[model samples]
Target: MTQIAQQHANMDETLMLEYGKGNDTAFAELYARHKGPMYRYICRQLGSKQHNKAQELFQEVWVRVIDNRNNYTVEAKFTTWLYRIAHNLLIDEHRKNQVRGEHLTLVSDEQDEGILAFHQGKQEGSVHNDFLQQAIKHCVELLMPQQREAFLLRHEAGFDPSQVCEIVGAKPETVKTRLRYAMSQLRDCLQRKVGATEVGGEREI
Candidate 1:
């Protein structure tokens, strides 16, 4: 990898260790680096229908980071540890919703601009591309909770299956199975939506 790539690979872990040492600037850097993707992850997990609740959980995730700085360790990548906290909180929220007999519902792509932008890519594409993006998001939301988490972590966070296992506290085989199923389901869903000719003809992830 290039020098910048190497730097970025270790930057999160370094910033986190500095934050643990009470370096507020380090904490700021860490937050700025991760805020967008982290927020998007929470919003996707909670679904856009609970935008307000996703915001609360997003804030709570950071607060927990601050409170537990002293307990931070380098056993895994900082993102892994960070998302683990988020995963736990999401589980708790899901449990509460379950007890209330509520299932989170997915909304339109407009519900989360960051995630929409992600699906849209960096530059604008054709109208067909836009429709495909929307269709992809809808299919992602249809996945079972565990499958969704694994898929998002792999695609959004760019983690490998082992890293995803660490983040979601699942075995390697389990994470692989989830990802396989997610991709298979997404492929089938997209094929049905836009026809098989358009499916797997675009991006791989």
Candidate 2:
């Protein structure tokens, strides 16, 4: 195999270790591989409308990753370690908002309030691109935080249930349940929004 192919195939943990040992190239490659999804994951957590805020947080995540390179262990999945940082930073923001008496609207499992209300769009039979995006975002925002976190970590970040457990510090069964609930909620919400029984084509999101 070509050297380029080998580099491309390097595991995240390996790249992290290499970066820890001062291999800037490995760190660059790892960032390239992870940046897109990491940004999206943060957006999904923070809200897509919070674009500038999300960008700021995304930069912070990378900065933390760089500064804490020495703290990473080869035993844990690199993505899990990265996610733990992201999650904690978000929690810190939530706490800050609370302290200022400016709490962000949270998804309540009971009341089912959505971030975006597009009731008329649902009856329209077909939702085009922008509408679809809004619908999915609204659906996501309606989910319980734990459920949404698990879903984004699993689907957006490509982490398995075990890795998700490690990142979230939840039990394996709890992680599985969160993922299941998240998928179920998304599927139902999207189906109602777009008049479809499925989501993400045949992939089920």
Pick out the ten consecutive residues of candidate 2 with the lowest summed lDDT. Answer: 109-118
What TM-score goes with each of the models?
Answer: 0.80, 0.74
Error of 2 at 14 (Å): 2.2
Residue pairs in candidate 1 whose N, alpha carbon or C atoms collide under 3 angstroms: none
For residues 73-122, what per-residue lDDT tens digits would candidate 1 score against the true structure?
A: 87877887888899999999999999998877544445544443454442
Q: Count the backbone clashes (under 3 Å) in each candidate.
A: 0, 0
Which residue segments of model 2 deviate by more than 4 Å? Answer: 1-10, 101-130, 195-205
Query: Model 1 Cα displacement at 20 (Å)?
Result: 2.5
lDDT of 2 by residue, 68-118 (tens): 888878665577788898988888876886797853445453333232234
Candidate 2 has a TM-score of 0.74
Candidate 1 weakest ten by summed lDDT: 196-205
